[model samples]
Target: MKIKNLSLLVAMMGGAPAIALASGYHFGSQSVSAQGTAFASGAEAADASTIFYNPAGMSRLQGTQFSGGLTFVLPNSDYSDKGSTNYLKRPTGGGDGGSFAPDIVVAPSMYLTHQINDQITAGIGMFVPYGASLDYGGDWVGRYGLTKIDLMTININPSISFKLNDHHSFGFGVSAQYMNAELDKASDAVTGLRMGAAAGAFGPASSAITNLINAGAISGAGTIKIKGNDWGYGFNLGYMYTLDENTRFGIAYRSAISQKLRGSANWDFSGVNMTSAVPGRFRVQSTAG
Candidate 1:
């Protein structure tokens, strides 16, 4: 194998999470070889990913084999001001503005399979099933909505396939996943609303508070940062039927797995504070961010 291949083998051994699903989570990626496709005959290819395809399907392949390739994924995203509410009622309606969206994103993938014997088949797969990203404009009304965002994951599945009859087969697979997340806080718009909102809730402080705010003494908007991650396990079951050399049907089921992402949101005096929070925000604010 090549250096790239070996390096990937090492990483797969680590069981990284994928970037798919809501909140930037993904389950798995596309398969590589035709044999890979044969076993995983349908959208539910998890089992046929190699020895992963119906193990029963492997009994069909006469010898050893290898399959590998890349998958190009184009992800488009948008983070707009559209409509929003200020918990503090700042009277500031977050306005629409220019975007800092990321360029088209392309992700890579691969898979490999081998036939062990009439009773069992062994195989390995390399693919990305999860990921995430962030690209907000500097002038975004919701800059505080989110910043410095990222998503990444890796999974390693070792599986087996077995044949049941002339055209029937069964396969199973187990996966281990590792995950991580990154976040950043945006600056405030106008210090007036951010600082004033504190007083609105308290009923009222004093000119001392106003003076402190005007003197920029109360401290403008504080920066908030968050981060955390988790791991999960799952399995796959699949079946395939052969109609002829060039015809067949496949069905596979993948169990659901849960990942708990834990992270703390914090405020920093030294970091960002947007110019204004937005519209719809009131006494909560006259102006904000």
Candidate 2:
């Protein structure tokens, strides 16, 4: 039942069977919490990702310090819609209208932090800040709307923190970013035109088939392929402050990165069979508040 509604929405979007997303499907799970204590000391004392958060905290640690953990994500995204028709024929085979659905998906991450010095601390963390993927049922009424999508991001960050004084400090890091992106969408069905044509201009639908008839409005069906990936480098800078023994604050800014992905999208049909060679850059920015 829901799938039908999904298909309808996809159809409205001028696509195949479903619609899912905010740009590419990659929304790296590298949530703000990982920076955990880096943003708020109150939160940091509880976890280890702090190695990546505010490694400088090591300066405050006594002996050896180590921290590591992983994050798992499950996203629920889908579509639903109604069917379009001309004559009021009770839908044959008492069944539902239409639908579009996405499978459950998960993305993971891990990081470690160990205090190395009293004033200068160092740590390493591997994480995916952005990642997500989705697929539509192939048999959907609007299969040509959106078929598939995938995107991923991985960051290997090694950082160091310095304690300038009891009240404030500074930290810096060299970041290596890896990115992968995929976008796939289908052409229009023009099913409306074909159905309308079959209903009108004369013949019964059963007979319409024999006549090899349908509205000419359905110019044609097309397909598109969009996929790309790129790798780049950047940096993260942070400042930490101790308001008191129980409270502290941290601010960090990650530089922007430009990922160049290369791919192609083509349209197939009668007179206008065309192909478009596609390539573009995906930019990313990180901010902590």
Candidate 3:
């Protein structure tokens, strides 16, 4: 499909917004212990969280081990309108868009690893590596652009590692990731009314439609909600080498996953239901690395 069409489809299907507080909607606090050192311990492999950072390090973990933690993200952001206009070139008047997002978000993660033998290890991990949430007041001036959005993902990784020797090790894993997303937004009432008026100039029935808009019976401030979820699979590989007793280097590669999401988009315009009488199903395929 053309890039424009695909972009439109994605936007209608609840794609992530362009502006976000985090790094590309990713919550990087996967390990509490690693946070102190700025996650520079990829090669340290001191905890079970290594199952996620680098599975090859699991071979260094003693017996069965488990690590669990929670990272609370308190994000502070707001939108300020510096003169805005609608599609009809009319000033969009509403209180300055205040707090366009939630005040706080909590993310949790867990991992388990077991040493199977002198040269082998097995591990499993559950975490959320990507997500975002934004909610703007319904009456905000920019409501037409967006009102609310929520996106979440959960990844389950199962992996195995082989200690090739005292200084080198290799690991491989498969991932099952589940993603859910929801989007809500308002349709531009003024723009819709202007279009209806233009159409009315050509036909009688169209004139009636325009009259309804002018009469406030069709205010044009419709709302659209889209919901979707999907599951995708991917793989990861890792290698670790011991440079000395206190220094080691690790490298890891994760493959991308393609997912086809299926869901329904519902529209409600002043109590008028649009999807109730039609097939509201929507499908979109996207890739995540």
Worst 10 residues of 2 by lDDT: 280-289
Cα RMSD, each candidate: 12.6, 11.5, 6.7
Cα lDDT tens digits, model 2, 1-289, are 0212222212322323334344544533343464453443432534445545555454455555455445544445545446632122322121121322234544555555555665776766677766656666433444454566677788888877788889787877777888876655544534432444344522343244323323232233444455556778877777778889877777767787776655443333232121221111111111111
Q: Name the best candidate (by TM-score).
A: 3
Q: What is the lDDT of residue 149 in candidate 3?
A: 83
Please, what is the TM-score per model? 0.65, 0.58, 0.80
Once superposed on the true structure, which residue ranges of model 2 sit more than 4 Å away at CA?
Answer: 1-47, 55-58, 61-65, 82-103, 188-222, 264-289
Most lDDT-accurate candidate: 3
| Superposed Cα RMSD, model 3 | 6.7
User: Cα deviation of 239 in candidate 3 (Å)?
Assistant: 0.8
Candidate 3 minimal-lDDT segment of 10 residues: 15-24
Q: What lDDT does each candidate get?
A: 0.49, 0.50, 0.71
User: Where does model 3 exceed 4 Å of error?
Assistant: 1-24, 200-202, 208-220, 271-289
